[model samples]
Target: MSKPDKTSRHGERRRFSPSMLRRGMNLYPPFLGMGLRVKEFSDDWTVCRVELKLTRFNRNQQGTAFGGSIGAMSDAFHALLLMHQLGTDYHVWDKAAEIEYVSPGIGTVYGRFEVSPEMAEAIRAEAAGGDKVLPWFETELTRADGTVVARVRRQLYVRKKKSVTERERADFTG
Candidate 1:
């Protein structure tokens, strides 16, 4: 198959495959307005960054990046990480999410979402049985000054199709 098109024109590593729904958030006014960047991604995890620009400033607040921006980043992070673990066969979608704002934003905010070993095992077990809601996790968005601005917990429902024994090695898509 051909390589998926890169998601950004500015040379950010924050690219996504065609199957990634979070990529569609680029069209969202709230997310796009925050200038979120997918700086890096691999099979294990994803790192996303965002800057609080004047456009993101509501009421001219300099310290807090838009709450929506932090939430959106959290959503994208968990969704993408789950996708990596579940692959394309099992449709994974966000079931629920929560964010806690702990402190004011200082500078560029970065978030990282990682698929845990236990979660992977749990997901595999879930698919082994049948389609089911795998698991959910929490991630923190922090500023350059080391202040955690928000904690986001994301829940996802994963629907399994063919069992691993039934599908080819390469049939798995994510």
Candidate 2:
């Protein structure tokens, strides 16, 4: 896997391509411990698919997937997706997140996070004037046979970084 690109003009944290992100995430200690695998990432970074296999280390007392594992599997992807979509000019963070357990995940469970072009456009428009935008995204975790196991809702805060000129103007105006 290619190293994360460090080409930002301002020398801030470098932006990672999908492949790099996938590889990095797969090696993350928490994810690795929880049996969470980043299965796929779209070239444009709009979609990220993750899987959690039922392993003895991750199973609950009931011999099913643990709830915490379920929630962990759904975390981070939405924020990562938006961060990549918005590029280096913006800051993206996970404002809030929630998960509802609908059914017990028996075997392998998968979660997919996708951001549409319209959603990206809307976020860009909202943040163009230097205002923060809070957008919501939802994803479902399902078993291989299409049994719904959980639904996750994530709220993200996105804001465009003000240029030096814009900051100066704001300071002057204020």
Candidate 3:
């Protein structure tokens, strides 16, 4: 598959492959410390799977996964997935999140984040006029046996960047 159509702030093309992102995420200090691993990323950047293994560093008094670790494991993935899908022409950020813990993650918990083509297109269309669009996404944290451990809901803020001319006009008016 081809690389995503991403650009830097200077408008130059940038190469940020899914594999690179996965490697970086895995190496990140917080994630690494908590035994979190980005196990897989689809070539299209729409799907990401993360796993949190039970370890001393991430275990709580109950000998299960720490709540913070569970929350962190499911955080930012939706925004990251959407950012790559929307490219650099737009801004994407995590606006809010809520997690409902259904069960203690005894051994290992898995979470999958996905932003379908239709969802991406809808966000793009909604924000095409330079207005901000807030979209909510939901997923489940499950165990290897397919038992649900937690439910995660995330909201993202997306907006199209203003054209150079528009920025100049706003600057002059101000």
Relative to the true structure, how large is the alpha-carbon lDDT of every model? Answer: 0.62, 0.86, 0.88
Give one digit per residue, the lDDT tens place, for model 1 in 95-159.
89878889765557777677765676578677766657647787777877778888878887777
Cα miss at 148, model 3 (Å)?
0.8
- The segments of candidate 2 whose C-alpha lies over 4 angstroms from its true place after superposition are 1-14, 166-174
What lDDT, from 0 to 1, does candidate 3 have? 0.88
Better of 1 and 3 by lDDT: 3
lDDT of 3 by residue, 47-140 (tens): 9999999999999998999989998987888898888777778899999999999999989999999999789989999999989999999999
For model 3, give the RMSD to the true fold: 3.1
Winner by TM-score: 3
**TM-scores for every predicted model:** 0.66, 0.86, 0.91
Winner on TM-score (1 vs 3): 3
lDDT of 2: 0.86
Candidate 1 least-lDDT 10 residues: 51-60
On the 0 to 100 scale, the lDDT of residue 111 in model 3 is: 94
Q: How many backbone overlaps does candidate 2 show?
A: 0
Candidate 3 clashes between residue pairs 3 or more apart in a chain or in different chains? none
Taking the tens digit of each residue's C-alpha lDDT, what string does model 2 give over 1-174? 975455432355556657787999899998888999998887766889999999988999999999999998877788887777777789899889889999998999999999876788789899999899999999999999998999999999899999989899999999
